[model samples]
Target chain A: MKRTNEFAVGLAVLLALTVVVAGALWLSETDLNKQQVTAQARFRTVGGLGVGAPVTLRGVKVGRVEAIRLVANEWVETEFSLDRVVELPPKPAVISASASLFGEWSANIISYDPPPTDPNLREALAESDQVGGDAWPGATLPDIGQLTAQASRIAGDVGVVTQRISQAFDSTALKNMQQSVKDLAEISGRLVEFAGAQTTRIDRVSRNVATTSDAFAGVAQTFQGAVARLDTATSDNQLKDILNNGRASSADLRQAAGDLRSVMTAARENQASLIRVVQQADSLMTKIQRGNGTLGMLASDSTLYRETTATVIQFRELLTDIKANPKKYLKISVF
Target chain B: MSPPVASRIAARDGFVAHIGRRSLETARALADVRTWSPLLMGQMRRLGVDSVPIALFIAVFTGIVLSLLSSYIFTGAVPLYFVGALVGKTVMMELGPVLTGMALAGRVGASIAAELGTMKVTEQVDALETLAYDRNAYLVVPRVLAATLMFPVVTALAMGVGITSGWITAVNLLDLSTPEFFKGLKLFYQFKDIWFGLLKSASFGAAVALMGCLRGLDAKSGAQGVGQSTTRAVVLGCEAILVLDAFWALVLL
Candidate 1:
């Protein structure tokens, strides 16, 4: 009986010790991070998001996802909790990303710059914990989804703009450009010689401007006196009839004045655009004059110019040969 | 017959003989198990109550040593608590059960074989048969059943002691933070492991008991016969325990 009692006591002691040790361990782990607020963020596609996913703000971990579940409509939602002090910034952008491609996907949050324009909109959004309010036009987020969306939008816009550009520079435009280039080449080939003998041409341009100004002054003076004539003729029958008949001339003068004003307005509106084009043209002309770069060298260098001409001549001959000897060049092999 | 055919015939006969002896051994074990079941309750008390202090010391010291040494070895790679959990699991699930069976077999298997061998030489077994009682029942059932039932309880005791020893060792020798160790062990360990060890222990008990009783029954004539039976009981019992352990590992683990 004594031996049995002793053995039982020993067994009981061991059992109790084990239970106490195991129970204490269990309790410590249970109490760890208890009562923390677990918030879930639902998304259409988590993509690669998983449990134990880190929630980061500007590359700093704010919290971690504890669990993941598929909600209604097969959208995956992540359950996560954050520290008490981690106040979410306004216009928080959540994006799924990875430290590396093969690594786990973490939800990164980036905050917007402080703008007084967005808070009132955000205040309306604060009512629903599920999703925040409307995206402020001034407020922008850089979430991974937003980045992907932006990239796609940019690509689409580029594609559309490219199409528009292609349409704008159509076949007609290309033909016109080719004609213009031919005219320019002819003019440039002669310009060197013309520059050495352009004293007469310079004088002629100034003389034309002078003559046109003179004509305008003469017309203004004539019209001013003509109005006096009309005033006196209004009392006489023949003169009044002539005045009525001469209304076309007065209308023509008014039309000329209107045209001048419209032209001035158009010039004013196009001043900056005209300046930009002029600057680009001037730079191009300067490059041509200095004989720098491809275009300058192409125009000035005789060797390249001869090669190009020869190449075009050869291309013409090749095309002629293909057309003439159709059997040899365009033969279809049965095998 | 040709040499090849003759050898093949001999090999087949040897194989048949091996199969026959193994079948006999299995039949005897089945009979012994049936006897042990009726006397299980009576046997459990004797084995568990008889061996306590040694079981306690060995289990406690073994756990402590494992916990301390493993803490040093695994501290860099894993959390100390996980190490503690591994120690707990290893002790409770395997070491506790197997060690308890070995200890009991050494204590009880040799005794059964030696006692019966001596009684056979002294003609006590014959005398019992003359009184119209079953020798196998009275002699074998009580000791074999006691060892079998005791095996599991002793294992349970060892498992409990081993876990507690690891805790104490983690605190004192490994200098693991008490709370951290507890938390780590808690997170890593499952309750199911303890039950798995208990099951292994019961199986081991049956194996040890059956081997001991069978060897004793097969004892021959003279002092050398007694010695041979004793030696066979231990060697075969230990070997069978290892083989059964491997088989169970494949099946259960």
Candidate 2:
């Protein structure tokens, strides 16, 4: 009975211990039952990633880092055991130590297409003892430190630009700009006044021009009347009549000039005859001076002059008698 | 010096000497593996198999409370499934083993101390020594060996119960799906977490048994001494477990 009791007790303890161990294993969730593939990757830096960190494919957990060690004192060689169910792309790329929301780091495969079916590539991959290329480092969300530094730099640049703008708008430049605007306004005001004066002058000149145009119109009307009169004279034969009258006047003038020339000739002949008579008279006067002519002798001899006077008285008496008796003294001969 | 002060100093010195002697005795007892092997089975049955019910109870309640609190606290910012991770981590790394050790300290430590104290007070221990039997090898070694060997088993059981209860609470009460709860449970779990818990539990078990035995051996004559020894065993065992837990955390983590 004692042995049986002891045996039962032993069995119970064994069973409880087994249960405890099995429970621990279950809680741990070790991949002891599942098949896993060992893959290796090399990195320059692991970025605080350690063994047992989750290996994810596009944010889904697919494996875990089994080991990490430095190789050749330069690169970190990480060996991970991925579940066989996860199919890796032919060129699967990984990002090392991507930061999570809670600041924990994880290894993530950014691309996860199926492996190439090419046998040559598969053989090469196998021979090289590599699954894919090195994972891109720092491919996670932007680091807070980097963002802060960039923000600070941008803020500094903005400050510099603001300062430059403030400096550019100093009092001197502001005053110059204000003066330029004022000058422009004053010049515009002067131009407006000048334009007004010019407009008044132009109006006066326009009125003068109108007056001149009216006078020119009168002159043009007179010229038109003169041209019409001249055209009438030319077209109506009045000019021909005037021309005939002018010719007749010229003929009459020529006839009068001939008559005048004949009269002058007759006058010239009379003048010669008169000149002969005058010469005979001049000779008789010379004889009288020398007591030649009767009148001259009478003037020169007083006695002769008395006798002639008596004779003239007799002649007078005779002429009176003839006048009283006309037929008496006159000779009537028709022959 | 005052009487009270002198007595206090003397007590402290005696405690130091007792601890040193206990350690020496334990080391010496470890050399007698052949004699201790036969007694380990009975002690293991008592320490491990007998303690499962209370350990499970504590563990189950711990899991439910952890799940409820974590769900409440991390509902919005964290995913609902993280409740399982929280419970698993707590049970495996801290609560399951530590709570089980404390329970055992109260249950097994008190009993061992009372039994040994009674034997000491009644002169049974002296009789065994007079009979040329090695008392430490026969009594202390078996108890320490049994407790150290069995504590991990109890801790593992506690861990299982705690995780299961946490899973149930998370899925049913917290509205987390079964798959999500399980994913979170296994999300951050590692083999080292279980190993570390078992190692700490083993150390705690040894400490509890050793302290109980030491206190009982040092008991005064009478019923009062037996009671005092029993109380001291539980108290010191609990203290040792916490201290060792902190030490292991510092060294391992």
Best by DockQ: 2
lDDT of each: 0.67, 0.81
- The list of candidate 1 runs beyond 4 A from truth reads A1-335, B1-42
Alpha-carbon interface RMSD for all candidates, in angstroms: 6.5, 2.9
Candidate 1: pairs in clash: none
lDDT by residue (A135-238, candidate 1, tens digit) is 21211123466567999999999999999999999899999999999999999989977876996888898899899999999998899889878767765676
Worst 10-residue stretch by lDDT in candidate 2 chain A?
A135-144
Give the root-mean-square deviation of each candidate in angstroms. Answer: 37.8, 33.2
RMSD of 1: 37.8
Off by over 4 Å in 2: A1-34, A97-99, A111-335, B1-10
Docking quality of model 2: it rates as acceptable
Question: Going through the candidates in order, what fraction of the true interface contacts does each contain?
Answer: 0.04, 0.48
TM score of chain A per candidate:
0.31, 0.36
Superposition TM-score, candidate 2 onto the true structure: 0.62
